[model samples]
Structures are given as C-alpha cells and as structure tokens.
Target: MATAREEPQTTSRARGDGLYYGWVVAWTSFGVLTITYGVQFSFGVFLPSIARDLDVSRTQAAAAYSVYVLVYSIMSSVSGALTDRRGPRLVLAAGGVLFGIGYALTGAAQSTWQLIVALGLIAGLGMSAAFVPCNATVVRWFAHKRGRALSVSTSGGSFAAVVVPFLAGWLVERTSWRVLYLGCAVMLLVGLLVASRLLVGRPEDIGLTLEDELGRRGAAQPRPATADDGAGATGAGAEVSLTPRQAARTTSFWVLVSIFLCTWLVVFLPLVHLPPFAEDLGIGATVAASLVSAVGIGGLVGRTLTGGFSDRVGRTVSLAAVLGVQVVAFLVFAVSDSLWTLYPAAVGFGFGYGGTTTVFPALVADLFGRAHAGALTGLVFAGAGSAAAVGPFVAAWMYDLTGSYRAAFVLSAVVNGMGLVLVVVLRATTPAHPGGRAAEPSPLRGTGQLAPGRRR
Candidate 1:
C-alpha cells in the first residue's frame, strides 16, 4: 500500500490544472449528495399527502421515515468499507441509481409495507453509499480548502431540502403524490447520470496529488492535528499520511464521533417534526410546505458561509458556532407556535444543521489525516446515522405521551446542549498532534503556516 506520507510521484502542480480539477471534484460531490441526501431530507414534504392518499395513519406512515433512517444508519459501515475498496465513482453512481429506482418503485407502491421496502430500505441504502463516499472523496481532493470544499459539497443536502420539498409540494398540487415520487425518480435519474459523468474514482485517477489540494489560493492554512497535540487518534506507527485504522486507537476518534452523534440526534428529530409542527400551529398547508423548503435555503446559506469561515477561523471555531446556533434555534422551536415565531426558528435550525454537515467532513480530515480518511469518516458517520435512527422514534414517543410536541422540543434543546458540551470537552482534551511522537510536526498542526525557510 502507498503510505500517506510518501508524496505521490505525480502532483497536480505538474499538470498546472489542479484548481480547475478540484472544482470538478467538488461539483461531483455536490451532485452525489443532491440525489441521495437531498431526497432523504425532502421526505417530510410528502408526509401529509402520502398519508392522505394512502389512507395510513400519521404514526404508521412515520414508519417509512423510521425505516429509511434505520437502513441509512445501519448501512453506513458497509458503504464506507466499500468506498475505501472501490473508490467513490461506483459507490456514488450506484447510490444514484438505487435512489432513482427506489423513488420510481415508491410511485407504484400500493401498500405501506411496499413503500417501506422501496423508499425506506432501498433508497436509504443508496443514500448511505452516496453520502459517505462523496464526503471521503472531498477529503482526498482538497487539503487547504477542505473546510470550504466540504461545506460547499455537503451543503447539497440542504440545497436539496430547500428545493426538492417545494418541487414535490408543487407537483402534489398539480398532480398527485404518486406523480411527485415519479418526478423525484426522474430527477434522481438525471442526477445519477451527471454523477456518473463527473465523478472521478480517485486523485490518481484524475491526475492530481494531495498537496495541491491543501488550502485555497489566498486562505490561511491550519496545521494538521497530530497525535501528540492530544490527538493520538492515529495511534503509533502513524505519520503525516494516516489511515482510519491508525486513528481508531486514539481517544479523539471516539470523542469526535460522540460529539457528532449528539448533533445528529438533534438534527434528525426536527426533520421529523418540522412539517407537522408547522401544521399543528395552524399554518396554511402551502405555507407550511414552503417552510420545509426554507430549511434547505438556510442550509445552503449556512453551509456556504460556515465552510468558508472554517477555512479562515479554523474548524473548531466553526463547529462551536454551529452548535451554538443550533442551541438557540431549538430554544426558539420549543416556544414557538405561529408562523411568525416558527419561520425564524426553521431558518436558524436549518442553517445550523446544514453547516454542521459542511464542517463535519473537513473536521474529520483535520483530526485524522487523509490516509484512512474514507474508512474513518465512514465509521464516524455510522455513529451519527445510528443516532438519527433512534432520534425520530424518541420524538414520536415523547409526542405520544404528551399529546403535544413540547416535550420533544425540550428534548431537542437538551440534545443540542449535549453537542455543545462535547465541543467544549473536545477542545479541552484533544492535543494538536498525536502519540506524543515527534518526527517532524504534522504539516496540519496549528495552522498551515510555512517554516522559516519555506516559501509562502
């Protein structure tokens, strides 16, 4: 195996086309997320219409959401292992196809059980493959701009949320809920086709090297986190190029995983609650539908702004900000009952949630290095996915008991607070490097500043 520390024989600078190539890779990652996570995020838009059309109870229809999350969470490991083995192209393309097929099949689903199998299981699995791999690939392609790149690409999920819900809602108004699914199927097909054309399998496949991707043309550079910086997530025998296995032995890996899981738990609970919460407040159906789109818009704004900010301020700062915003948003959510109050809550929550997606992948790469990035991120995301699976049900159970969403809202606040606490703990405990081992300080430590003799 080619060790991460061994510079690639070829560099993107040698081709003088690395910048343009990096954008291509970033766009590809965006496309992959658009179909998979985008569709997944839009599920709430179809909830009321799907339930009315199918004659299922809201609680029963909610099962589809539960199943989708369950499968998505459960399959994350498999997706990561596969991404590391096959590269992202096949994995993302397959996800696109599976998602497209799942939506198409969902249009024909005559029973709740069939919908679960089609949209929940098949589509969820597809998204799992698409999202984790695309995230890992972005880690490979951009080093300097990793935060911004990941923020931009992962923001696609929020973009889809912003767009797909409104589109689906309009389609439902114009035709039927089934047709909405058919439209999604067609869109997913197109997204998959685009991903197929654009997604290069690896950096070597695209004729680039990792260094060309370390930061932006004029951005401040942060040093890679090292094992000794209280970041021994990469264990012994590790160097500049570290892999997931190398990082697994360290305390940072689990801490990162724990922190993210807390955030995701908060993230998914609201996804399930948003549409109905608006409906319960006596908001107009169309307006409520539009609110679903607002989350996406907030996410787009959040991801774009936060990702770029992380490049300048550092990943930890951005992460902390996102968690803080989430805390405030959930606090608003717990008290709000009208559109006037809830609209702002939706925007804040979506923005914070969306930004979290953008920051997470870059943070993972910063903490662990790129050698085993795909596998490590996969494992970390798997924990987040598992949290997502349980979160909605927890919300539902709370609602079932209270006959009101207040308890659920309070619970979301608590979960977000937990994430904030972890963020504090993370900063306090993690070293800038790993293993207390000093060969040369990791280039990724502190910030990506050059040594005294090195050129700017």
Candidate 2:
C-alpha cells in the first residue's frame, strides 16, 4: 500500500523526464477549448436552420445566442472563484456534464423558449465553468512563456472554429440540426473523459516548477527597479500583492473591463450573424457555413501568431494592430457584394478576433498577478459576456429593421475602432509593472518576462 501510494507521488513529481508538465496542461486545455468552443461556435451553423424550421424571426433566433452569452458571462466570475478556490477538475467535470446534457436537450427543443433554456442557460453556464478555468490554469503553469502557453491552449478554440463549422455544415447537409446537437454531446463526453485524466490545476499541485527559457526549472529573478519606478510607485507596473478587492480599486482594472466590453461587442457580432448574413446573400448553406470555417482558419493562425507576436511587441501594440485589422475586415464585410470578398473579410475578422482572445488574458496577467488570475480574468470576461449578450441581438434587430446586415456590420467596425482607441489610451496610462514601477531591462524584455510574484 505504501509503495502504491508512493508510486503516484513519484509520477506526479516526475516532470516528464525534463519535459515541463505545463505543456501537458496547455494541450489538455487545448482539447477542452476545442470541444467547448466547437459546440459554442457551431450555433452559427445551426442558426439558419433553426430560424427556418421554427418560423421565428432572425432577432428571436439570435436572442438564444444572446442569452447564452449573458449566462456564460454572468457565471464567469463565480466559476473563476471556484476554480481558484477548489482547482479546475471539479469545475471542468461539471462543465462537461452540463455541456453534453444541454446540447442533447437543445436538440430536442420544440419551441424558442425550450431552445433558450437548453442552449442559452444550461450550455452557457457549462461553457462559463469550463472556459475561464482552462485559461486560468494554463497561465499559472508558465511565467515567462505565459503568452505562448495561452496561445497554444486557446488555439483549441480556433481549431474548433475550423473543424466544427465545416463538420456541422456537412453534417446538417446529411442530418437534421437535432442530430448535430447529439453529435456535439458525444464529442463533449469524449473530450471531458480525456481531459479529466490529463488536467492539472497548477504545476505546484503536481510537484513541478515553472519552466524558464531554456526549458529547465529555474527560480524567478527579481525585478530591478527602473527610473520610472520612483515617479509611479503606486501604479499598475509596481510589484505588489493585491487581493481582488484591492485590484478592483485601481484605474487599470476598470480600464481593462471597458476594453474587454468594447472589444467583444464587435467580436461576437459576426460570430453569431455571419452564417445567416451569408445565407441572406443567397450563399448556399454549406458555403455559408464554410465562411465560419474560414474565420476559424484565420483564427487558428491569429491565435498562434499573436501569442508570439505579443510576446515580442508589447501587448498593447499587438492588440491595437489586430483591432485595426478587425476594423478593416468589418468594413470589407459591411460592403462586400460577392462571396469572394466575403471570404477574405472573414479571414481578416477571424484573425483579429482570435488574437483578441490571446492578448486580453495576457494583458490581465500583466496588469494583475496570477494569484487572482482566475477571478480577475473572469471579471474581464464578465464585461465581454455582457457585450456579447447584447451585440448579436442588436445586430439581429438592425437586420430586422433594415432588411440587410449592412448597418450591423458597419456598427461592428465602429465599435472595434472605439476599442482600438481605448487600448492605445490604456497603454499610455499603464505602468510596465505593478505599483507604478518602470519595467526592468532584460534579455526577454518583450517576450513576456515578469518579476517574481507577478506575471505578464
């Protein structure tokens, strides 16, 4: 019995013979995101079918997704707190169960209310539980490499974007939308089983340390005070332990919330309406669905590239660049007259949208230490969720009013531009370190290095 117990301890502490266990966490997070977001994003593929079959207006149909976003966003803070307090295993397990059940039931809904309950409330809550925890967990596993780690983990959503829409489009061609939900349920079940076995809450929980640049275990170096440190001793750049309440009191925290809210307002507009908009343009269902897949493809590239890019360029610079790309993409989407133009537009928007997911969390970690990462990230997401809740519905309402998506698409571009402005202003205001300190010079200055007890 003692040998058996000791064996488990040895395995936990093994560190994969010099391979950081954090990579395992990153990949496992990737899997969970792939499954969760695959189902979440597939809603677009289902939108046209559901609206046609149920005989509901586009605004009503889009409301289901709005509800889903609302529920998901509202629960984010609660779930983040749970993940922080109890670790991610239980939260993720619950999420998988809810996700599977919610999709399965959504498949059976006979009315709009039933659809809302199944997809919006249940599935949204499940996604809330699963999504934030994965990002939070992966962030805790790496210090200097947090941006890359986040990119790798979140790329799962991009992967899902590529695969799920195409798969759903194809499947819906052969099977009913109901059948698609059943398929989502099965996928979630299988993904959860695999994730359960592999997910680790943190490196310390498994007796490992954060990896340094050389991929060896090393202690974090102290942050040397810089010239700006004396001027802004209480700014965001200083290294100080902060409770969630304390962090909430700072100007940076509220600025992040505003930025998240505005960014996602634009981000989710297309996510919910893109497929339907294509269909309205006389694009075939399969082809329209492929547009979403295009976004996913662009997203996959963006997610992967931005992680490393942000690590090199400052997060604010990288964020502003992607947001600018989104503005251009949305403008193209707003005015495009043909499917050819639409396809390129989708790629641009997807790239920017995917990059936002990567940069925002890293920005949060930069502004707030990882100690309350789960809660802090969740707070940011709460704003995003709130934006998502209204953004699509507003677009749908615009469509209802104008009989075209042109106005909605224009609105998306405008909001993205606003978000870009906010980011630029925020970068100007935030200190490089917590407590208003100037950043120290280091070999990995832009590659996401941080002081001990803090993370970028």
Candidate 3:
C-alpha cells in the first residue's frame, strides 16, 4: 500500500554502492534517541531549579517526572500499535511536534499543575511515540546483527546521559532553565525533519529484503518479489513473527515484564534524584550534575559492550550479571558520602543501567520474534514505565519522611537483588534452541530460508 513517493529510492543506491541501508536506519534511530532521551534524561538538572522557582516540595516537583513516566508508559502500547500499522515516520513526526511544543510550554508554566500538563502529559506522549517505533524498526532490519545494531542505536541514550546533565547544569548556572527547554524544543524539531526523510517502516519498503541469516539454518529459499508485491508480501519470509496476544500468553513474557519493572524501579531512583542527593551532601550543583554524566560515561561503555557480549554469552547470563552489579552499586551509593566514592558508584550503577536498555529489546526479539516486536516490546515496557512512574515518587516521599536517601538507596539495592533472582529463575525456566537462542519457531512458519550466498 505504499505510495510511489513512499517507496525508498535508497534501495537501488545501496545495492550499487555495496552498503546496506539498514545501517542507515540504525544510525538514524541513534540520532532520534540521542536527542529525545538526552533532553528527557536532563530532567534531573531541571528538577532542583523547578522546585526552587515554583516553591514546590521535593515530592511535588518529582511528581511531574512521575506523571510523565506514567503517561509515557500508558501511551507506549498505543504508539507501538500505531507503528505496527502506520510505520515509524508518521509516529516520529508526531512525536517531534508534540515533544517540541510540550517542552517549550514548560518554560511558560507558573504553577506545578501547568508543569505537569506541559511536561508530564504532552511531552510524555511524544517520548512514547519515538521509543518503540525506532527500536522495533531496527529489530526488523537486521537478523544476524540485531543485538549489535540495537545496542548501537540505544547507546545514544547513554551518550546523552553522559553529556546532557553536565551541559544542562552548566547552562542553568549561566542562563534560565526556560531557555534550556526552548533550546531542546528546537533540537527536537530538527530531529523530526531528519526522521521524516530517512525513517522507513521496513527494509522491504525499499525493495531490499532482510539479511539472509535471519531464518532457520536450513529453511527453503525466498521467492523473488514481483513489482505488484506489497511490503507484507516481501517480508513474508521473515524468520519469525508473532502477535502481541500470542506472545502475552507465554510465561516468559511475564518474567521479562517483572525483570523490566524491578530494574527500572532502581534505574529511575538515581536518574531523577541523583543531583539533589549529591547537593544534600554539600556537593555543588555543577559537581553533582557530573555524577549524572559519570553514569552516562559508564553507560556508554556498558551499552556497547553488553550488546556484543550478550551475542556471545547469551542474553540471560548477561542480564543476571548486570543486575548483580546494580545491587552492589546501589549499596555503595547508600553507604558512601564522599565524591570519590559516589563517582565510582555512579559509574557502576550507570553501567548496569545501560546494559538493561540494550539487552531487554534484543531479549524480547530473541524470545518473541521480530514481527510484532514493537507491540510486544511496548507491552513489556509498560512494566518499566510503571516502575519509572512510581520509583522517583517513592524515593522522594521516603526522603521527605526520613530526612535521608539512605533508606531509598537500600530499597533500590534490595529490589535490584530481587531482579537478579528473577533473571536466574527466568534463565532456568525459559527453553532454548540448540544454538542457545530462545526458541521462537512457531512464528517462523512460511518464512523461507536464507539465500545460499547470503548466509552469514
């Protein structure tokens, strides 16, 4: 059903130039995530300012972020369904506009309610739109390289985490937080333009098929597509496909959801409150902000390394190890007061946190298959979204009541330990194929084998 204008001409150029267009998709996804999550993650930098400026309690200020996460989680499944039907370009375009407008409006808010409406509801919807489509698109584009490609694309968030907090903190010192929000709005608009131009729904929309190594080792060859063929027709040979309902029926899905929930509960605690926590310890705001940047630095390494490592070590093992590190990191943060101690703790937490972002998507695809990846991943992400919504608020309330972050940090460590236990259980319970990949053969029916010369 693609219009003539919608069909990509890049397919022909890629065939002639000997470069796969899928890499283009990967980098484009990277750019989108970098800009969106970069701005999104910078909320901690703005949190203190918002509290000081609006005369709100820490719990009230944190509520804006909580609401954002709540709305974002609710919208993710909707966006994922839309992406499955309408494609990423439209979804991303809408996201860009919504994110820009919502962010810009936050600059004008005079009260906490206005702030929540501008940032929590509107901007949250925008982020929801951008996340699943880009991730699901990348999963569909590569088979042999799915994990690496997803990692590379998601590493943008880690890269953003490293840079944005420091930059926002520095800017807040020199300028108003309002200007920062407006600047982010402009950047999102530019990202939308890029997404509209380059973000295709599937590789088949451009006349290229998925990489040959995507299917079973000895499956039959795919038939050549005729000019009249639709995108679905061309992609009929994808190795495995599944509906969201079908995937939801499996026990592994619930296990994955629980893991996501616990990890995210721990992840968002530091992300939303790390700066204030550091400031409470007598660290300067700029220096406190650097703690966030340190997390980003560690995350950058974690995301990239975990992606490629999971391919070799298997997803469950990599996940369990990462969760174990998170538990130790939280405990470190709970007991430490010195900047020297906090820095290493930040790096450790960030590294483990970054690994989850990379591993979860690849794990979902590995377990459920690529066909309905967007919807299923979105459904799974609802767990994280719920955790994101609740975690910060809980931490803020705990701090307000107890007059310290120690209890909150201790709670994070405990939950993360619980996550590690779940990962172990998941690993033991989930069935694996002969090659060690999660079994997904039911969805592979009718998807022909890789072409002879095209196998990896």
TM per model?
0.85, 0.89, 0.88
lDDT of 1: 0.70
Weakest 10 consecutive residues of candidate 1 by summed lDDT: 447-456
Model 1: CA > 4 A from native: 1-19, 214-239, 431-456
Please give the TM-score that candidate 2 achieves against the real structure: 0.89
Candidate 2 local accuracy as lDDT? 0.77
What ranges in model 2 sit over 4 Å off? 1-16, 211-215, 218-241, 431-456
Model 1: how far residue 189 lies from native, Å = 2.8
Tell me the tens digit of each residue's lDDT in model 3 across 173-292. 899998899999889977876786787777777766763334322345554321112223343354545578776666667778888888887688888788889999999989999999
Residue 202, candidate 1: alpha-carbon lDDT: 58
lDDT of 2 by residue, 1-456 (tens): 885685445444443444466778889999899888888888888888888888898788888889998999889988888888898888888888888888999999888999999989998888897668889888777656777998999999989888888888888879899988988887886678669677777766755555332344343444433211222243323333345786677666676788777788767777778888888888888888888888999999999999888776567788888889999999999898788899999999889988999887777766665667788788879866567788889988998898988988888888888888888787665446665433432211222343322212
Question: Tell me, what's the RMSD of every candidate?
Answer: 6.2, 5.0, 5.6
Q: After superposing candidate 3, which stretches have Cα over 4 Å from the reference?
A: 1-16, 212-238, 431-456
Ranking by lDDT: 3, 2, 1
Better of 1 and 2 by lDDT: 2
- Cα lDDT of model 3 overall? 0.78
